[model samples]
Target chain A: MSSRDAILARIRAAVADAPEPPPVTRDYRTAHVDDDHAAVVDLLAENLADYRARVHRCTEAELPALLARLLTDHGSRSVAVPPGLPTAWLAAAEGAEQHLDDPEQPLTARQLDAIDSVVTGCRIAIAETGTLVLDAGPGQGRRALTLVPDHHVCVVGSADQVVASLPQAVPLLDATRPLTWISGPSATSDIELDRVEGVHGPRTLEVVLVG
Target chain B: MSGTYLGMPAFPQAAKAATRDTRLRANLRHATHTIRDKRARAVGELDDWAVLREAGKRIKDRTLRHLDTYLLQLEEHVTAAGGTVHWAADAAEANRIVADLVQATGETEVVKVKSMATQEIGLNEALAAEGITAYETDLAELIVQLGDDLPSHILVPAIHRNRGEIRDIFAEKMARWGRPAPEGLTDRPADLAEAARLHLREKFLRAKVGVSGANFMIAETGTLVVVESEGNGRMCLTLPETLISVVGIEKVLPTWQDLEVFLQLLPRSSTAERMNPYTTMWTGTSEGDGPRDFHLVLLDNGRTDTLADEVGRQVLRCIRCSACLNVCPVYERAGGHAYGSPYPGPIGAVLTPQLRGTTSAVDASLPFASSLCGACYEVCPVAIDIPEVLVHLREQVAGQPGHRAERAAMQAATWLFEHPAALAAAERAASATRALHPRRLPLGPAKAWTETRDLPQLPAESFRSWWQHHHTEPPTPPEPTS
Candidate 1:
């Protein structure tokens, strides 16, 4: 038999003796038992801050202005923009130079080091554990856009996108795609278990809690 | 078996030395207990934990079942997105693929994130053999590399060493690597971090190639994800002109939407935090943003073989959250090195055997390392039945054709029990000859058991015979005679 066939045969034998697996219930209640989306976003924002991610709150109208100002505050000169990023967001940064880069761009170390910030939309936000996920999609650029920049300003819509628990979020995802889950700025406490920020990914992450 | 954990002794012999080290045991116990307790509390905060766990398990299982289809879809998506995917059947193939990719760029050095998959494949060692230097940017990884020590835990590779050991390692070894520690580097956490930051920053700035392993791969979108507490992963991913990610095939999930579940489960289970500090992800590649060139080396190694076993395939469901490791009593005592692989603890016990095959002494002995305790099960975010797998592997060992003598002995015992009359006669004869019995079995297969335990002395007479002699007379007749 072919190797693949042989593998399948062995798997069959190994699992053949197993008691049949319990039936899977794909039917899940996803109506989100949580009462308020804004409340959940608030909790998530609060938790993100706890992990040292700079958190900002703004209305939809103020989002672009807030993002531009935040980028300026970080002294960002060239901001990486995902192709699907809200044009309005960049339009607000009228004076800030923009580098519309895709995730797969090949750039030199110094080149990436020069880029100041990246802006993207989030896939989902978990309130129970203040975390945000970016599936490289519209608005969210290639995963690198989030990683290469010193600062990341992610905008999360306060709506049904908020999930109270992972169980509620599982069925919503397909396993075969690339998924990036962000909880806070990349940091490690490896040196004497001393927490240090920005060894590889973004050193400073800013989340826009847009209501 | 190549350069990765080949010629490693059986788990028992390796654990023997580790268990004897009282200080090591103390450190391991303290670290494991603290992490495990904190993890328990963290998990306890979520009411829907069981549901989440079940979902995680099912999602992984389903994805594994249709892995080929998903992989094809992922490849299509990635290629369309301007990324290249390479399939590697084993470590040799993976190393060759990655080395060739790096060579194509005419680069001799590369930055690396903390990746277990890369370690499992012995990528750095392979690259070193190819005359390319790979810099470990993760702080713990740096310490492990500088000290020439094996990682002892999943989350904390250097948990066996304390602050002073780290300072000593940095003071002595930093210069040889490239950057030296600042003069009079103290054991203070801040000073140590600064030293590492200064040391790794140089590599990050100079390296033209980056290597990493993904936490997850989305098949639908052809995206690879790396979730780490350290930002070094991001640096290796983005700063380098070329990024090569060596990912295990089992890391694949179906779609981007599926990332949400794992994001919640991984952090709390691993670092005992509500969320991970950093998560880096990328598809094939994009122009004008990050690394313009991206290579995803999809590594199978022994995963497909492992996946064939239904009882063992559950290992693939593991998110590498390492909750099981933190709670493992065996791991707490013996530490990670005793497992003799990149993967350790309860997961390692079952997984290594399946992935590596139960052929070597280390692989064969791993099944017996565990106490069959189920604490790993309780704390596992995905609920892998580790003890059950260990026992199953033990049975597999006992049932192997090489154990002919043992099988025969068990068969003989079975036959004796099946023939009760013979069994009774044999028992009576043994009882009658009990005084002739030796304290220990001499020159026999049973000697090993007899050496540790004494045989019970026989009764003065067979109980059955005594009952027959004394109780045969009727009570009324006895009373009349009196």
Candidate 2:
């Protein structure tokens, strides 16, 4: 027999006399924050800032200037732009050159690393854990674009994209699509168990909450 | 320097040497205490932690009970999603399958995400024997690999090393692999992290094949989740042309929804984070995105044998959180290397013996390594009741033939306790010879027990005799009011 068949046979025989497991109890809190949307967004901002990600709140009209200023302030000469990103978002950023994520010709890791920053939109934001979920959907490029660059400026829509907890966020995501859940910039606690951010991923994560 | 665990001494012998190392004990104490306190605070943030933990435990149990069904379902979905699936009954088969896959890619080198299953089977060493280089990408794993040391802890494999030691390892040994450390490297955590990033970035970009182990495998969607703090997992999971994931059969979950419970349980329990920095989920091969060729190797080295026993089956539910390790007093002192396997601490004490069987001296000694403090049970996300399993394994070990002296001693004590007259006589005789007793036993296996502990001094008279002489009155019968 093949290993698959033999292994399955062993598992079947092992659990032949096993009793049925009890039903799962999912009585945990779905939302740790208040029901109010404003409060949930506020909690999201607070949690994001707590993890050392620079959190900013601005109106849709102020987003372009904010992006431009952020790019100029970080001294970024080139920025990675996802294919579906709103062209207006980078209208004010004249100093930094834009590199689009082309499907036919993908940017290599070395090329992405050479770029100064990456800007993308998120699918959803969880308030309880301060995580941003990117599904490689529209406005969000592939996982590598956001991972290889040093600085990441993620634009999140506060009114529609913010959820209060993991349970609330899970149902909103499509499991078939590739998902990247990032709470903060890349970090490591491997050295004497002390957390040091900026290893192998974006060193600085700037979350822009657009109202 | 050789990174090998072969021919290591049993637990007691190894632990004796570890306990004497003041530096190692201090390092372990500091690291475990820091993580333990933070874990408590993180878990405290959730008002319904117990409910979530119960849900997590039940989900794993249900999946394992119908594992055969889930395994088949997973294979079908993965194949449908354009990924190949292979099954390995033991370590040798799993190694051969991985070596062949790498050879097919025609790549002599592969970057790897940190994986316990691969380590459990000694995959890297196997690849080396086949003339392929496997680079460990996780920072902690890199430290272990560079220092030519066995991993001392899960979550943080080089937990026994301080920052200075890590700096030294990188500065002295990194050039042998690929990139050398920056000139005049310091022991700062940030500096060490920077050094690692520069050293490994080139490997991640140049490698054609990547090897990984998933935290969870969704059978319904055929998706694999890799939870990590650093982006090394991402680099290995995405940058390579071909990605191979070697996962244990027990890692499969029935649906994507099951991840909601474990994702909450694992991060807080292991790293004490609200959520780890990165959690990447993908279903098989994706065009123009990640790796084009994907392979899933389902490993069953000893899981089937462990699943066969009813009382011992709950161990299969472990999510490898490492929470039990931080909270264990014995693990805090004895350290992880003494366990003599990839796994360590409370989970290791129960798991290694079951996975490898109690035939070897090391495996047999693992059950007795713990103090049975029940702290491991309290903090276990799945509520494994490690103490109960330890006792069960101890019984199995005692039933084996090599412990003749111990068996005889236990039988003699049992006989004496069965006869009251004999027990009284023995107690009186022991008390009479109390003065002749030495503070330390000078001979045999009993001397090992007395090496660090004082033998209790005997009293002048037995309690039974004293009670007989002082209180001669008969006990009063109680009146029934009802």
By TM-score, who's the top model here? Answer: 2
TM-score of each: 0.77, 0.95
- Residue A41's lDDT in candidate 1: 72
| lDDT by candidate, in order shown | 0.76, 0.92
Highest-DockQ candidate = 2
Best by lDDT: 2
The CAPRI quality class of candidate 2 comes to high
Among incorrect, acceptable, medium and high, the docking class of model 1 is acceptable
> Can you write out model 1's per-residue Cα lDDT over B1-482, one digit (the tens) per residue?
23356687877667767777888888777667667767778777776768777877778777777667677777788888888888887788899999999999999999998888888888999999999998888788888888888776677788887778889999999999998999999997657766887788778887789999888888877778787776677668866789898888778888676666676678789888876776666677654546779888888788877777767788888877778887787787778888989888899998888888887878877887788879888878778888888888888877765555546777889998899787778778988788788998786546643453467787877676677789897666444554
Residue pairs with colliding backbones in model 2 are none
Model 2 C-alpha lDDT per residue in residues B2-43, reported as the tens digit of each score:
677777788877887788888889999999999999999999
Q: Give model 2's TM-score versus the native structure.
A: 0.95
- Model 1 has a DockQ score of 0.28
Predict model 1's lDDT versus the native: 0.76
